[model samples]
Target: MTVTDTAPRALRTPRADRSNGQWKVDGRAALNGTEEFKAEDNGINVRERIETIYARDGFDSIPDSDLHGRFRWWGLYTQRKPGIDGGRTAQLEPHELEDRYFMMRIRSDGAALTPEALRVLGSISTDFARGTADITDRQNIQYHWIEIENVPEIWRRLESVGLETTTACGDTTRGFLGSPVAGVAADEIIDPTPVICEIKRRWLGNPELTNLPRKFKTAVTGHPSLDVVHEINDIALVGVVHPALGPGYDLWVGGSLSTTPRLSERIGVFVTQEQAPDVWHGVVRIFRDYGYRRLRNKARLKFLLADWGTERFREVLESEYLGYRLPDGPPPAPAVGPGDHVGVHPQKDGRYYVGAAPLVGRVGGATLAGLADLIEQVGADAARLTAFQKVVVLGVPEEGLEAFVDGLESLGLTARPSLFRRSTMACTGIEFCKLAIVDTKDSAVSVIADLERRLADLEPLLDRPIELNLNGCPNSCARIQTADIGLKGQIITVGSGSGTGSGGVQVPGFQVHLGGGLAGTGRDAGELGRTVRGLKVPATEVADYVERVVRRYAAERTPGQSFAQWVARADEEALQ
Candidate 1:
């Protein structure tokens, strides 16, 4: 079939069975797998609808599908704020919700940024969004408290800086991630920026990809840290060297984490830097035509990759999409350190790039704007955001290194941070995210501060870096399942005065998981976190409990035993 023929409509007409709430094929519910929505022509109509209808008519104008599904294409979502309960909220109409504001997201194809772009971002947040700005795990800027009236202005500002919200949140080829230190890293195998630009140039808002079974995610990284979380995207181009081709990308398909967590599998093909975009196009087209569209939960590219396996997926791509075979490639280099670009690193260009960490990826408009000034003042050519929620200022001259570090420090952005401060990650919790269960940003800040204070004496023995991810829910948007210490927000009953849940009540707490890590970082990476039975910690006491566990690990660990290895053999009682 031609590329145009790969559209979802050209495929079989879906036969829906919605007896189980949503559309279902065999008693299993689907996302928007109903024949009705699929038969509605195009999901992209929301763009015109928003401009002509919704914006003109306010919140009440949103149709159910556009409110929940189509609005995402423009990076808009009605965030259910505080006082909005779990039940009934999901079923309620967007206008019926207490808060009518939207959470606006701006897509960055390569996680790349510039001073002009950031100023626009900061302006949008401070001017229109009430100073609420967050850098998401996917390396995009997210704003809350946005209204329909403000969207036009926001889009205008964004467009002025060469940024767009199109396909940022929809069931299309959402934002693709690239290395935070893409062109500047000293140890990078290859720079993937050009490939990312090519992909965006060809398919940013192309209508052919606007309608898919479900949302799609992609990442391309050449850094040794595996900077983009390669194992967790639908299609990832990881840096690898071919025996004859030198530096190129190794292809991986079908990685995702939600209720079902699966690390991507390498497809064993070497794609030259020039050929990367075509390969990407081929894979996504294959997904469009052959992917499972019958079940929402099962419609991710991972499901197709899982069922087809890497070999078959590659075979179809070669035969149906690219019409040519690709050369076999080698595996990515093992990770040397954490992917977050915090701290100072010398670039290959004899300059320095500073990766400064903001508290748990939470930064406001003025701060981001201030950072834009710093980037410009320091004579840095550009700045980029890391998947780790850190920002990297690139092209700093050697003379400006000291000034740059001090400037970041002045903004409360840290170049050198404590292990706990550097390692902690938190998702957008109950504050804005509708799916979140508890408060995350401040709680994470509090927990990290507490951990830093109480564990001060243990700082010397903290040789092994720990990954502590606090996700407000089990959605894994923060990749909680792949962290060393994963905290899934929940309301757990503490029978008596227990750790954080010590109020003799079932309050906000976390279901703790241990031993998870992304692959290629340490010698032993890429393992999912372990779940212990009845392992729940009150949010208030999380720091204390984590301290106790770390102390025990330090004292009891065998020589060279990583946290995951120790957790594998340690007595079950010691975990608590």
Candidate 2:
């Protein structure tokens, strides 16, 4: 199937004509500032400028338009400076908070990596980014401390390894998330590797899709584990079998999180493997043509779906984009395994794949390089990064399994991680993200260590892992709203202190959200966590609070009651 280069219909609709191409309403005749700037120049055009002008001339050569707006198109962002506390996050301007260095995101489409590719990533991190790298939830590798002058060489190295930063950020199709064990899993319904590869080849660098109303995320998964967190992406295709058509994908759309969180709604469409790429193209094009654009906050596809609803959306997609109707089909079967994929698992090929957990996604360049050596020594050829911020090394034979596990442990990766370590997730917080209001990676690490020690006795009482997601802001970059214990970071007033009539000291803290979860936990659909009134957890006391609430759940839960179920039924007093 061919994705056309035609401009989206919204660009030439009656609304566009009325506003003389500005696409405004109520005779306002004014586009949002960001939209107006994008119209002046395509964000991709900055790539040439970055290579030719900024790389040689240095960071000061970048104008504000390109620095703040266009740079994100290529996955570059100015990281936050050290020593800046959460209290000052809102008081200072961006330039004051930002460091000269950049954070570069490497889009690992399908999260697959060869030994050679892994080495290159390791070397780049060590040589260019001060040995710092993070495995993001969307299955991309993020590096910090990048300089403008080093970007060209970094891009060259990534391209050599068949990886890229293109559309890894900004208002474009971000990295496509697939099941980490896409092709090798023993019980996968249908491998999505081919569909993922085809979609990337056809539309990855296409200029037509480089700009959208806002970021568009996509996920495809064949694993019953539901490993891609499909319920919260803009468009997701979960593997399922049609009653008569055999195995295919079920379409879900409009899932997102932030200050306003929304679970994706299935539009009752089934897609065959052959039609997957075309179906994805059609859905993205529909989003481009008809999505909200006037308000930046309202530009995500979720808002559009909320307004149009699923039935009208399906009709428009078929008529305007696909030119054909998709058959109504069944939703996926309930997730049967832990989505994180931690520990050893058998592969369909009679070999084994080992899933290892890194501490809250933190792995240094040296550790990664060492992991590559272990993979080669163990005769493994493939590795994948998971949505839960873990790594799976594939193709290990029975003979090398013991040695491989030892090697992973040496590199500080654990195939057998504790429940707390396996379930906790954190975003880049005040340490690197300019928008973050609190520290996340370090805070999460501390909490994990504490929980492991404190919750050891209660392990037998738990049947499922309780997801603890920590975000540095209300933006929900860590998928906080869909975690069992979602923490949105903010500064809260606490304790009577000098210089205050109301008497309080400002401290880094979180607003707690309980019972949020996705379909992987066996709920019929994704559910957002509910917030309790007047509950604020200080950053320092996260471990203490989590321990208290968990112990309470363990004591009070009935037989076969999941943590989410307990939260749903418990009184407000029990939650605290």
Candidate 3:
């Protein structure tokens, strides 16, 4: 159990500092702040300024078991209703905000900007009160509500423009995710922005790999296509070539999807690009020294490679990388092609990188500072952020791709192509998860805007792309069994009294499931369909029964069928 005897389990503070709380700090006040000041307030230590702002940013003062201070107090404050907390509580405004936690990660065509990073992200939305700044599904840029004593003056104005909240979110090593058109796409095969800037310069602020056993994800794509799902990642490298092992990368290993969904295990060999950080420090020190700490539902790292299996977790990660020497490379060029930075392309230097569509990946803070002023008026080298929430701007110079798609449609932002926010995904439910039970992002944008206005003229019925995923419970944290119309929220029973009243009683709803798919040949694990009783149906008649089962699979499908292979050739009373 070593890892200092599996810590985590003490944060319950908040005795009405406007309750709905959390607070903890100590460990030399989280490492004496210096990312440009603010940890020095020293008012007799509030757990030493939250352990010196988590050790001046490097982290790991203690606390593990997936240390949840409500994921660092709602990713830095925004729960109000008492004389409206911090940013003057506008019950909901900024463009009629339906709370999609702001997003925007600009760069592609504007080539990785800098004017001190757009004047430190426009002075962190003009002196912290954040109110909007998002672009993450991994391309990075998030700054929603923000306000917990203005997060040490928004971390001293995002370290005076250099920008950083440090490893951007717990369990460390986050925010290094690459390929929003890395090094200009045009079927690129190996560029991954200098190995994602040397894996964010040796694990951004490494304090001996900041507390683990969970929440560690990594990816680097070199574009052998496979559009950045980078095998869901516990560690993924991608890009290939290897005519006698040359270009590098094919690692993969323990993919994930909360509530234990597995799907990433290839272990043993192929790493080049200079032994990708010694195979990422021998698979994160064999999951921080033999994973599983008495099971918090099997602590991740794909349940320690499913309890030491993948050839004994690659022989204890080659006996703890016995002094590193493994890079003999070779084996890794068997058809790793096909790219999808979604839409428009061209860039081996000639320049171009569009891929817009931000719908369900929402965005606001003035469209995230007009996507960082269109990467400071085009020129940040390149900018990316896909995993399907979309952004991809890159080098663009075919005469500035029609004025950067007409300046992202005059800042209302949209690169077109919409089918209810590209496949939909909802999580921060019960209005900011206290382990939600409903309201998953306004019932997944009101059931995908009533099933895209009732399948608007049955738009080519099905034939691919269907993922729905709406987890308010079952703690799947929004992986909803790899989605294909997943749902999961359960509590049913509409009237007949005794379940309390006021808001017209009858509690929970949404159990659906249906042909869940994840695109792994067997087409993404999906089943358990039927359970739509959200108080006798009304989430737009349960999205009009999944849009009349996709218009009866577009009039009895065939021809390259897919919606989970035609819900596996419908049966069981035609899928209920």
Candidate 4:
């Protein structure tokens, strides 16, 4: 594809150089405690210490500096102590709530996993993590109950399968989310797997970009479905076919969700496939140099984007970083279908890809091993994971399709799941997460089961999937604000403030957000859900609350109206 060729301009006063030689310092002082410590030592250096010291000496040997901060660079976090209820989540300190066990995240860029790799992951989970494995929204696999003693062995097993947890967490470039059906999708605009691979190869563990002000997320999708949730990523390249240039990518920057949620903006630039890697590198470097470091809350690239605005951001990215002006481009076409490629679908080849949901990404070790066996038995090419916490088995021959589907059913995975099963998503809540205020995985599963039975009659009236994203906290790990029904886990007071148990009570619950949706999911653009004032559904009554609202939606919505559309225009009384 063709692109604009603008000569590089000489640098005058570079914004990235504002920090000077001080790592986290502005002019005279360190930004925060994190900045002060991070300046003292490179986070990546902790690997040697882990391998030589902590692994041998055990959990207590780890210093708080490495335990709380540096360990995250390698995707390690101390898991929540067992038997700790949601009520005590915020009451206790981080050290008080943390157990000796750990939660390790394994990066799975491009969502591609071979049968052998699947087997290894299953083995790792079974042996090291007490059989805990959950597919994160970013396509990484998370394991709980990990120990410092087993981390080295876990790394060895993962590396043997061409996987590693480096930069999976912390203030680094996290795993790049790609379309699960990247190269295999029938209607793909351009296979983004190559770009993802190229960027990973060059920058995955590179020390140059190892330490950013905060975590930076990247999404690359060539599928027309926009499968990678591009609008919510820090840097995204959406597939587009220029009128004259044919197929390439449209640059999008500064999308993120958390306490401060912001939809990414298209930078109005077209980039050929060859230029993608360098462009990605430049943007990240810009963040590393110019991003906020003073306060942890304002450190995300989104805040910088807000300060600079899209036009100025693009100009700096071009002149200061890329050293070349990219061609102006059109926005991506509206998504043609559901981004989550659930159920059976045809691949580009004569073979097929069967997508299955596993109850909001909860796939245990034995099940993963079973999947590997099934893949081999069915002669499928590979198994892929989706952003929606589902798995897709690719290259299933037409002849073995029936057998593969049956095998998936036997494993509690469903290619043809109910709408609730297919759309509901949840984060790792109080069960394992230290930051969580309420249960999520179990909560989401419960909601899906309840809705499947309660709203079965309303299914015929629904035209599109109604997404329910359940998050453990305000962090939005499950993209709570981008679902038709977003439930943010919180502990709310149920009765008047007076006494214990019955008189006044702080109970595990959720604050509801309605009508949120992304462009890929049917809205023309991304929209955050609106919060209903003074509305809190107790954890025990979430199912009842959802059922009541949904039944009302089914009874009142106009013809051909999407759940988001109806929720947007519906009155608060109808929502309640």
TM-score for every candidate vs. truth? 0.91, 0.94, 0.30, 0.94
Model 1 Cα displacement at 388 (Å)? 0.9
Model 1 scores worst on lDDT over the 10 consecutive residues at 1-10
Best-performing candidate as measured by lDDT: 2
Error of 3 at 13 (Å): 34
Provide the clash count, candidate 1: 7
Model 4, 371-473: lDDT tens per residue? 9999999899998888888888889999999999999988889898998899899999989999998999998898889889999988877878888888989
lDDT, candidate 2, at 249: 96
How far is each candidate from the true structure, as Cα RMSD in Å? 6.7, 6.0, 25.0, 6.2
Report lDDT per candidate: 0.80, 0.87, 0.54, 0.86
Model 1 bad stretches (over 4 Å): 1-35, 85-98, 496-504, 520-523
**lDDT by residue (tens digit), candidate 3, 199-237:** 566765565565444457777777655555655678877
- Check candidate 2 and list the clashing pairs: none
Tell me the lDDT of model 4 at 152. Answer: 92
| Model 4 backbone overlap count | 0
The Cα RMSD in angstroms, rounded to one decimal, for candidate 4 relative to the true structure is 6.2
